[model samples]
Target: MNRVLAFDLAPKKDYIEYINRGREERIGTMKVSDDYVRQCEKAKEIQGLWNPDVGDWIYSYGSRSIEKVFGEVTMRYTKVWLPVQEDLQAILRYETPLVMLQAFNDWLYTDSGYGCVNGARFHSMQELWLAFVMWERFSKVWDGKDWKVV
Candidate 1:
């Protein structure tokens, strides 16, 4: 099985963004560009895919914001949403409770308190969730064998 790392699953070019309606509205009112409407529509389009709830993690192209009321405020960044550990556990349990419990038990008993799968060490809950997603989508697990991408 090929080794897969947690960072390998990170988005290279695109990222998710949080749309603060009040802030955006005020900013939009200050400007004449149609960026606000476009951003809202883009967010809507993305949200339409899974019908995500309030706390569900979703993907986006990226985002930017302006700060410093009196100076030139230009800041751009990628806002990747990392799921909280409890949220991830709930999601996994909802999908397959027994399997999740068994996996958790196995990991918990390991000498290393960290979670590692197929040589991928997960330092945080976010990394673990990303690994799970990658494995579910692109990996295949053979009985008594390491995971490999199919």
Candidate 2:
């Protein structure tokens, strides 16, 4: 059985709020245009980083590849952690039986995208910790019974 556990410090709503609050501009202030472009170029250095067949239309374009490159490092784990915002939706869309940890106040996670899988919503870090404990207990119970989880 392959078990994948993914977590994020805050939910998507916080991300949306931060993004809307000019967090990008704050980060951008320290970055030079030429340097940023170089960083983007470096992101595309790996092969099959994005669906090569799609050409440039790849979701993140150059940026997506950088994430993919790091994802490759954990390719052998049979489970991937996508604690970041936006990407989790993409992962759930493509992968089945996903375990998603959401926050009620989070704007990014809608009930619509969560398909046939396990999902838990938390209002605080304490709740999130409880969810993790529950997940571990459930996993142990299922594993003891020789149930297959993927």
Best candidate, TM-score: 1
RMSD of 1: 16.5
Q: Relative to the unseen true structure, what is the C-alpha lDDT of residue 44 in candidate 2, on a scale of 0 to 100?
A: 26
Task: Give candidate 1 regions above 4 Å deviation.
Answer: 1-49, 57-99, 105-120, 136-150
Query: How well does candidate 1 match the true structure in TM-score terms?
Result: 0.32
lDDT of 2 by residue, 33-106 (tens): 22222222332212212232211211133222112222223232221121222322332332333344443223
Kindly report which residue pairs in candidate 2 clash with one another.
13-107
Question: What does candidate 1's lDDT look like per residue over 31-148, in tens digits?
Answer: 2112322332333222233323444332233433221122222231222222334544554434577787676556545543234434244333344443454344334322222334
Local error of candidate 1 at 95, Å?
A: 7.9
**Residue 123 shift from truth in candidate 1, angstroms:** 2.5
Deviation (Å) of 131 in candidate 2: 9.6
